[model samples]
Target: MLVNAIWDFDGTLYDSYPGMMKALAALVTANGGQIEPKTLYRQVKETSIKQFLTGFGQQVGRSVADLEADYHQRARAYLQDIHPYPEALAVLKAIKAQGGHNLLLTHRDRSAWEILAHDQADTLFLGGVDADLKLPRKPAPDAIQYLLRRFQLNPAVTAMIGDRSLDVDAGINADVKTIYFNVDGLNAAPQADYQVDHLIEIPPLFRK
Candidate 1:
């Protein structure tokens, strides 16, 4: 059966890690604490900025709110660095050619799409719902359900493609197939229906 796929934007579609790391490092230093770039990157991936900074502030002597504001300010320019992963655009094109329906579901603000929409012009994005929308982010299934209802999709034939465990959980919660795109088995989520190392491997899954 033909399927509709919902993709996660951050680590899945675009490699925003480098820019995120840069922004986070600057944020840490600006708040009078010193943290290694790699360490900051890992922390950001594992926890949200508010929680991460709340913990960090306790270690140093600062308020989480101040640190968060600084991080957001420093991260403005970094958003422009967001770019598609290698061959991701080509893979998306192939999915479109196969008559697969595609949509984007992310925790990022809607404005992030204006900067991140490159090469995705051909896909049917229902626009970003954003974290501020108060809709539960991935792993809660709210965003997935919204997409399904909006697009009139069948959960059984639909798929969620992403690089994190949250993506798999979201798909499972929404009763859809989950495709894990972690090439190195970095994220070992139990809900995944298929595991692939590269974007090019996606097209074969639709084959009869």
Candidate 2:
């Protein structure tokens, strides 16, 4: 039986892209750099913030630190405004009801997504580890490994779910079941143990 869940905060649970896009756009524009909406969206969906900012910095002739500072400053104010998918709370509650322990790991700052978690459904998460924790980010397996070891969870009973390929890679790296929340129905899917189109679809997989 599935006993634990490691969730990805940004795209998997919360619809944070719109706010993130605005933050990136405002930061680049304020820095006198122009980034097309399509370019920003594709990169954000594909890579880490640091990677994107570094590439963007090179493109715009600014320090990554400068772009990053502006982005984070702008994002903090908009963080609380992010909302989960309509099915997110229902799925979280369902997992808890089935005796699964839910944990969250994200690249977002601890101060940012935590507000939305409290505002939406705080009770569903057993714990959350974020960038503030100083743990290595996902696709490295450090954070998830820490959670599994600390909690004494069996790897076989754990599943990681996220919308990005990085999320899948993290789970695979950690040797747990991985679920790709393919909301976009992309023709080229990530390598995951399972794939679901929506949060509501996840519960049935665990039930089996």
C-alpha TM-score for every candidate: 0.83, 0.91
Candidate 2 lDDT by residue in tens digits, 1-208: 6778889988788888888889988888876888799878777777677788998889889898888887889987777678888998888888888888888888877664556557667667888678888888778889889889888878998998898888889889999999899876652345888889879988876643
lDDT of each: 0.74, 0.82
| Candidate 2 weakest lDDT stretch, 10 residues | 183-192
Clashes of each: 0, 0
What's the CA RMSD for each of the models? 2.8, 1.9
CA displacement after TM-score superposition, residue 52 of candidate 1 (Å): 2.8
- Over the stretch 1-208, how does candidate 1's per-residue lDDT look in tens digits? 5367688877777888777678778777766779877667566554455667889889878898787777777777787788888877776666667777768887777645675555545344544456567787568888889888878888888888888777788889988999988744456665689888888888777633
Residue 167 CA error for candidate 1 (Å)? Answer: 1.8
TM-score of candidate 1 versus the correct structure, residues matched by position: 0.83
Q: What is the lDDT of candidate 1?
A: 0.74
Deviating ranges (above 4 Å) for candidate 2? none
Best TM-score among the predictions, by candidate number = 2
